[model samples]
Target: MMANPNYASLKELARAKRAQYGVTTEALNLIVVRKIYSDEGIRIDNWEFPRTIRAAYMSDDADPSVAINKTLPREPRLFSLVHELKHHYVDRPKIEQGQIKCGDYNENQTIEIGAEVFAAEFIYPETEFLERLQLLNIEPGQCSPEDVVRLKRECRACVSYQFLRKRLVRLGFAMPHAFDKIQFQKLEEQLYGPPIYKQKWFQRRRGRAQAK
Candidate 1:
């Protein structure tokens, strides 16, 4: 069994999907129509799970069904939908036999991690997303956290602020540590609405750094 997923290959898989579907953005319709699962006749539906389990795709006795937690916000729900679809790419046999459980989907396990990467890149194709950012006047090495916020709202793209930040770093739009103390605090507040512990920690850190 492979210990880690081939990220490059998975990226190529996403690229291939883009080329095949003639879509510049994520082809969610493929998953909806069961085409992305290839010839498999998996059905998509909404089944509310516990808060932790956002989605599940089961292939039991050759009966495949994908259930999504509809309570999730738009971005997370979309990501989880893709994450479950990625299981078909990661382990076909296990998925076919109902041996795989994507419960701990957020964990660092190889399959889970691969699914996360697949979902993110699938939703925001790197080149097209970069072009979208560029159209917003946000260029590589020139974008700020504020620019990302504006883009998120303008594009109406479903992605977390953290994901947006990482995407910016990946695309060379910002340095790894580009958002400083104040900026990071502002971003956190904007996304999550004033985290208690993080607020105190950032305050102390900002004070000490400013004193320096």
Candidate 2:
């Protein structure tokens, strides 16, 4: 029987894969998931998957593919893509033999957790995250919701606040579920106004009104 990989091993594997794919920290900040998929020859289809199913991967030797939930926002979609990539790399054989399954993570807890670890590390490595926090002078137990917003704004990684919060908790930087009830999007908007697209749309509307 194969030994189940622990978190540290999974993280190392993820980092190695990142290196193999030439994924640098700068690339991660720019969100290279789709580029990585193209490089790996994995086809992507955005479908309206069930809410419970964020994404699914099929390791078909002839044509490997990943189907992601179209309704997921940008950050989640990127994360899910990387999550499926993990399965593509490590769980392909088990998946092919029907020894593992997707969607329902509970059935394959260890593998699923490993995939999560891989995705997280691949997207935003812990060392970089810690470095960013330290640069910002954020200490353990000192991160506030506002600080989290700042982190997201400054970090440049395409990840949700939930992802950041969970990472903080996992690294003992913050208490678990400490920011669960905070509506991060709402807070972000309140702090920085609307997102760039919305600002652009509003500017366009004003320009049209002035011309009229």
Candidate 3:
């Protein structure tokens, strides 16, 4: 019999969902994240924070349902949930024995970046995100807030549009050299800046060096 799947393999999960279930990559994304997170004792929500939260809880098993804070923007929430998902990505029940403290800053910084990558790839499939955006007649130039609202709604992305746009760039679908062509140089004026990743490249590289 095949072994039960773990969160360790995003590539595998994506492939399986495609070959086995015939699900779209996006839907496979949701399935993989939900499966990995649920096993790790993290609660996946439908409408709560929309992103996620991962504080150091004092238990072997986490609470079944995490609070859904609707007030926060979806970008932060997605980042948060993605963060928690990474905790499991490392080691689930074994790590949860409190052998490793859950949600420590050092640990969080280590794990969250990968989760962000996973989430970004999942939410913004390189081929799909670019095509979808093209269909909307939208480029990343700072559209009016009204346009932002309309574009996001059209994409069914109620979360942060700019945030997703930046994620697209990181995933290599966005044309960074053509940020001006996308008209973002002018539009990015509204938001303070690009979407932030959890751990920086420098820190990640430093850690990898140490590990090696």
- Which candidate gets the maximum TM-score versus the true structure? 2
Per-residue alpha-carbon lDDT of candidate 1 for residues 1-212, written as tens digits (9 for 90 to 100): 44345876777776676566564453354344246554556677877778877887777776677888878776677677777767765665776654655454344377777777777777777766777886899877988777876776666455766677777886689888775443654664687577664577888998899999
Best by lDDT: 2
Which residue runs of candidate 3 sit more than 4 Å off their true CA positions?
Answer: 1-75, 97-99, 105-108, 137-150, 168-212
Per-residue CA lDDT of model 2 for 1-212, tens digit only, reads: 45555878888988998898788765563247777788889899888877888888886655789988889888788788888888888888888776766555557877788889888998889999999999988899889898999999998777899899999887778888889899999999999999875798888988899999
Pick the winner on TM-score between candidates 1 and 2.
Answer: 2
| TM-score of each prediction | 0.65, 0.86, 0.46
TM-score, candidate number 3: 0.46
lDDT of each: 0.68, 0.84, 0.48
lDDT of 2: 0.84
Clashing pairs in 1: none
Q: What tens-digit string does per-residue lDDT give for candidate 3 at 51-91? A: 44433222344453433355555455554554444445444
* Backbone clash pairs in model 3 (N, Cα, C under 3 Å; residues 3+ apart or in different chains), count: 8
RMSD of each: 11.2, 3.5, 15.5
